[model samples]
Target: MMAKIKEFILLKIVIPIVDMMMGMKISYWYKKINKLNSLSRDKITEWQNRQFRDLIRFAYEHTVYYKEIIDKSGYSIDDFTSTDDICRLPVLTKEIIRQRYSDIVPDNITKIPHRKHSTGGSTGEPLRFIIDENTWGYVTAAKIHAWKTTGFHYGEPFLSFGSSSLFRVNKKNRLHDIYYKLRNAIALNGMNMEDSICRKYIEIARKKRVKYIYGYASSIYILASYVKKHNVKYKLNAVFTTSEVLTPEYRQVIEEAFDSKVMDCYGAHDGGITAFEIERGSYFVGYNTFCEVENPLEISTLYCSNLIDFAFPMLRYEVGDAVVMDNTANTHYNGQIIKKIEGRTGDIIRLKNGHTITNPGFTVVFKQFNVKAYRIKQLSESSLVVTLVVLPNFKKEEESKIIDTIKKYAGDDCEIRVEYIDQFEPLENGKRRFIMSK
Candidate 1:
């Protein structure tokens, strides 16, 4: 009962003494997500239409912005042979990939592997792209089959309250602290979280054996509202919310403060979109990726054709968020599900050490700089109001480097008020609250 000898020295003596001294194979993405969850649903729609016609014939044979938007949308790859011509092309926003991220990359920059990847101006600014290794093994096998729908296993013990996932257990890289202590993680930095480091990881998650507690549904509902107001006896087998918008009152307060059960994984980080959840809360948009709706069944605007990155070819791409679909899908992942995924809210700030962070740490400080839109308004608990909309190569020391990166996380006795907007006014259900805190 020494919490079962610290779960037997972290599962029988430090995980096989750090997986046989780092020969590493930590379940290798749980055996490629159990062979993609033993396929079927017509062999995942014939391997998603042969990986969407081999990324539309490798983006019209080695991109040039997908051969001038598929030769000016007269569409071909023989009119997308299947997936019903994914809306005969057109819909790749984020101001057309920030007005052409150098002609949507890929000028045969192939030494035959890729990786740059950026995004933290969450659907408005910061975008850097390029991801290979077969689109990171189908976005890490659809986030380990959406954390195997809450019953997560394979050497289980995860704790990602994101905003730059804080890694600790004294890391100074000794094989990255024995690879995050044999992959039984303990990352913290949910944008500066710390109730004495969340009660020292809730007393080492009530002794070792911790399993699944994912991130950013407003920083895991501010660590389940301080572990349900200090009655922190722990135990969890599920809680995977992602980026934001979980609301059913934050999924009944993150399922009554982590007694557990609440899996959500709606996507975007421009890897097109994933949409995990598998029933009762819907979301099955799997079979890699291929979805559309610029206006179909209301809260529209959501186009994606990311058959897993294909070295930056988000074909019908527009993932600037706004979804809603209850059905449809003539195969490939059985039926289209995805009902409700409103525009971004994963908002939360609270810092001065009491800790809580959101929107992956304030959109990575507006990633360098250049904007066509921006927002962040908290108004109290140490005021803030920083609306911006510049971009004609904005400069004035980049508005004092964007108010010194929002006064480095609205602290230093917060009072950051830097406004400059020529436009932007759409709430009252017309969406646009990239991060708000009333």
Candidate 2:
């Protein structure tokens, strides 16, 4: 009752004024997204065909790298009449994005309202990119639309377990405090999901009547396991898991604990792909991304083309995930369908003192450095080795900062060592694993 009243005021009144002040029309995009969600399958596909052609033409004219690639491939921009023509271009890998970052971005970037962003380094290789405000607004709208499928209304309280570096509030910012309060969000540090912390989160959720939970799959699974163990009495409308693989076992446990559906969401932000599970075993891919499957027999890789992001367009970008594609008709949505996503399977690292560091947690400190790739191996519970493949701009002093930041999580008594390497040896599975233990 209270939540509905707050939602009415916040969404209708507060949000518009905030949008007007900030010069961002996320609400406008949100309304458009709701309309897009109701479009017919054929109409959505037609829209995608047009958007893809425009994006390709824009990339060829604005970006140096795409112009060279298209020219060298003996293909003209006019040839991209349909979305299928994207297969002709070479796949844009993480290495290409890193080496040719400047050439890939447009010359008129200074005039755009974009922010510097980095991937969570789930694959042990983080790619930094730019996302304009337009793209940001669309993504936010799409996310809210996805949440609404689970009967979640905006302005309702929710619990988020994520990286402390990203979600933790700045003590000095009163506005941020007010924003979280108004939004009714409680963010707990996912890196340290100890039993005590998990218990406190459950208490807060029970007290606040938070019907939604969102965060990394492994972190949520850990909390779910604790809930099931203690026989905690909690019921939620939905559990939204992202940023990591949602295993069958994890899904069963989470759904059983919450007595609700677990909505799995996938987003390759750099490549601008987003999908949300609307039903069991059926994921609805968003209209803004044209997803293509490569080598699909049992498992396959995904190549995503961002149809909306014109400022920094990633045409046919390799997302580096193995997924199962559903060939069934798009009965649930106007867009494409994915059967299951085999995302980055994150592992939990336990310290000698019983503290834990979750997947992509260490990736936070590496973002401040110019390190290209990194791996953390636990030689013993107390001793650790960090191997890094750094770029030319990587400074020597950044090494100590990595050690200090890690020790803050792993503990002050933990023995840490850092190693620099040209590259990592190829794995048998052909995937990079960052968190490992001997």
User: Which structure among the candidates has the greatest lDDT?
Assistant: 2
Which lDDT tens digits does candidate 1 get at residues 59-81? Answer: 77877777887888775567776
* Candidate 2 backbone overlaps, count: 0
Q: How does each model score on lDDT?
A: 0.66, 0.79
Model 2, residue 96: distance off in Å is 1.8
Which residue window of length 10 is worst by lDDT in model 1? 21-30
Name the runs in model 1 displaced over 4 angstroms.
Answer: 1-40, 43-47, 54-118, 121-125, 128-215, 221-227, 230-240, 244-260, 277-285, 288-355, 358-361, 364-368, 371-396, 399-401, 404-409, 412-438
Q: What 10-residue stretch in candidate 2 is worst by lDDT?
A: 167-176
Pairs of residues at least 3 apart in sequence or in different chains that clash in candidate 2 = none
Error at 108, model 1, angstroms? 23
lDDT of 1: 0.66
Q: Candidate 2, residues 323-423: lDDT per residue as tens digits?
A: 77777676557778888786676567777776666775666657777888888888887888999999898999999998997787678888999999998
